[model samples]
Target: MASRPGAWRNILRRQPSSPRKTSTISHISLPLEIPVEEETLPYYEPEHYYPVHIGEVYESRYQITGKLGYGAYSTSWLCRDLQVLKVSTSLPKFPTATDREPKIYGHIAKINSTHPGQALIREFYDSFDLQGTDGRHRCLVMQPMHMSLLEMMGLNPRPFDLPLLKMTVTRLLIALDFLHAEAGVIHADLKTDNQKSTAPPPKQIDESRIIYKSRKFGRPDKAKGYGLPSLCDLGESRIGATQESNPFVQPHIYRAPEVMLDMPWGSAADIRNLAGLIWDLFEGEHLFGAVFDARGGHDPFKHFALIVALIGEPPSEFVKRSETTGQCFDTNGNWVAHEDEVIPTVSLDNLEKRLFGQEKQLFIQFMRSMLKWMPEERKTAGQLLEDPWLQ
Candidate 1:
């Protein structure tokens, strides 16, 4: 298997292109037996480690292929369905965005899409509980996808083209639309890792490397399709009607103003995240970049300063609504001055001009609609779908 091996760590799944060297890695299927010694020289240890290994069975049904990833409280494993792949029975599904929303798995694929800017959700297959070394963990069996948007962007220095970014965001927005409208769910945590469309960049991948096994993990045949964008990792998702006293939680870059400011968030929170997500997808960076204070504090104030710098100041009324307003800003609606330096504010128009030398009015306007400090002022998923700039 090691054709000419040094250390077989990553599988280089190169995408073949026409005239240039543009390649993508959309899927990962690992062999049953991985031969690296667990005790191989290692200086680092992860905080949370699950005991899932190569060639294990779970729920007496799905065979564990490999570990997809792990989060603070959960682990995602690639499990092969022993039932075998059925073209007619599967009916092409979108894996539910996260393990929390078990019902939303097949719902996305069934929805009729008249909207122009949308992508399919990942298809879900099955789920069961597995007892790990820690405790009982939920194991979701779903269709496999390539690396996340964040992973893909990191693969290439150049940001994604406007068309591709817009298209992918549209698909994301539509997924939110379905979750909010059809399913009445709120994806409290929405970011690049949870959104999948483009595959990670691979090197020197060829046809010989392509393996076709009807019993293989994930949708192996889906390598060369149009690449449907889908939301993932729904462990944080909650039904809209279900009231939550949960604290602020989301990646620092995508954290909405209200969440940082200690305000009540709802479906609007997802919209706010979508704003940051869009900027990240296009510019390959967060609209509100992260920073540190003089005291090395990593709190809402520092995060909020980044927001103010990029999207302009929050409304005074919006500040009044926040319970933790005093934490980040003065009564004048100005961010508390840092002990070290003055934080500067930059509008999207200025950002566009600084980068592209001209104003992107439509793009700016579209972002403004979602970047509002007030959750109510932000566009709903349905409203975002109809935003002029999305087209």
Candidate 2:
């Protein structure tokens, strides 16, 4: 059967061998009639083989403990460093991989040989390929973490307290700053699920049973809880200079308007997303949910309804600018403009009325200001950090 041009090459290169090598293998010849590019290839499924058992060791170094969370392309695990004897037993194994052992070993070796410092930063560990046992072939080794922010959010009975919220947001911003300012990288997917907590010391331990401390740190008030939040999951991360877009960024809720408009966005967009996250922390629900019409797909209009409901319709000038940029707008019934020509429109008083009606609008305004359609008009992370609400 013919396959897509790129698809055929990928398949031919990645074909797996049988478990046992045969001395006398039969050769079967087949004719290629259809063009490779036109052939339909089977969907590529991720290998499910997790080769390394609980106590397995790779390269005689890092030891595997257990699985962490799965990312778009990789699975993290908790592992321990064998070289550090003193802290080795005390420190629980951080998240490390148990799948695709050989490939992971090769990657670690290569990284150690080429970029030793960077490899050290990555904390080399082990993963395995359970081809014979299962069929999966990929794995990863990484630092150990406790509950992710998503887990923490679900675990907390009460909404995030103001100080905790600010602390969390600040830490995230700082992480983003380090990525953008120093590393020249962009964390495309920033969400609660990707934020992890540092692992606490283990208490009771056994071959099969291990006791761990709670990730949550209680606040002065018994009702609230907090933890040190650390950013994780860099699979979608890219160098700042790279111009490609990842297809699987967080949903529209966390997406910046510039991204929604299909415009070229940089690190600033990350700030916008962080702002939305902060709002969610305080509101205890997605800020854009009311405006979003799930049935309409991810159209901005769904959010436009929210804008109208809160800040009123966008101004004609704003609409005109949006139109000039080929943005679409809808005028209730009549066809005022093409979908691409329509721009967001609303009056300021309508916005005030919608947002200020009964509930306090200050925080909402803070978030909206950062979500401006025009990138230049939006507030920066530094500016948002100084906002009175946060203070």
Candidate 3:
């Protein structure tokens, strides 16, 4: 039972593209669908339906302000502390419950049941909830940021400046380090839509329009004249040492090679994803799309063709290792011995011959290392943090 290096291709056989027609389901009840034509478009649709606002207090403290974003099984919300009085003299009105110490039961009780560290988002003043729809919906409270990474990239298709890219990736890596190393969590759903930016830079700070600070504390504060990226959305995030089933991971474009191979994965898979995200920041486009769509459905031959164009063929030893792992392989007996082997003789010069030049080689090497089919072969976040590219 040798593992086939091309097993990935067999597992992702493509189907014909769907006809360009909208489904009949009403938009109000169903999830919002971003049409392919507007795929790169960036504008927040306020009317997007989120979870129901049941007018309930959570953990007898945080008050739900509004919906922030939605994930596979949970919805994110902007919340404020009911116990913390506003600077204004006006007293705050708290919600009343029918049951005595109603705070002891209902939504508030559900909130109190979860751990506090999980509740707070890294760096920012926010936290996440694990309970899904069956339990009281998890609410994440934090300072509001305006746009997502998707929106920012959509607005600026060009590669980000070195400073900005470093800052963004550094903050993202820090958050990921906390999730993986410190909190022992995996944000299965990491994407542009989840990384939000603080409110847009103010056109003018004060009536006088006097000189304002250009940079604050070595980081950009968009309110002053710089853009800061924030990571959000944790519904698909897993915590503790347990491996829970999750079907809400980001599409194939952001998925790591191990995830694509359906192999048992861990925090290293997240490091792979972060690597792809950094590539996206540099390339201003997804890398895996060269293979297939995120939702699946594409010609196998065509997908393989694209892969060949980018990464050449897999090495022979790679194939043998995959087959030994019982990974998905073409059952057809035509190439049985080769089934568990990969032919990695293709050279970088050959790859560059197909794409661009030196830069392309650097990018390909970096991506292929992170996208290795084996988790053990993949680079660690700490290793990537020291890459000369980041410096």
Per TM-score, the best of the predicted structures is 1
Query: lDDT (0-100) at residue 255 of candidate 2?
Result: 78
Query: Residue-wise lDDT of candidate 3 within 1-391, one digit each (tens)?
Result: 0112232122122331111222221112212242221122354222221223323344445554333443222234444542211100111121111111111111122232233332334222322232222232222334455566666666654767657777787677666665565556666667775523221121221232211111112233657744456555443455554443332354566665444444446777677677668767766666555554455553233333344344554454444433432332333212232443333344334432323655556556766667665566766655666655555
- Scored by CA lDDT, what does every candidate get? 0.55, 0.45, 0.43
Backbone clash tally (model 2): 28
**What is residue 191's positional error in candidate 3, in angstroms?**
1.1
Model 1's TM-score against the true structure: 0.68
The local distance difference test score of model 3 is 0.43
TM-score of 3: 0.53
- Which of the two, 2 or 3, has more TM-score? 2
Task: Point to the candidate with the largest lDDT.
Answer: 1
lDDT score for candidate 2 against the true structure: 0.45
Candidate 2, after superposition: displacement of residue 261 in Å?
Answer: 2.7
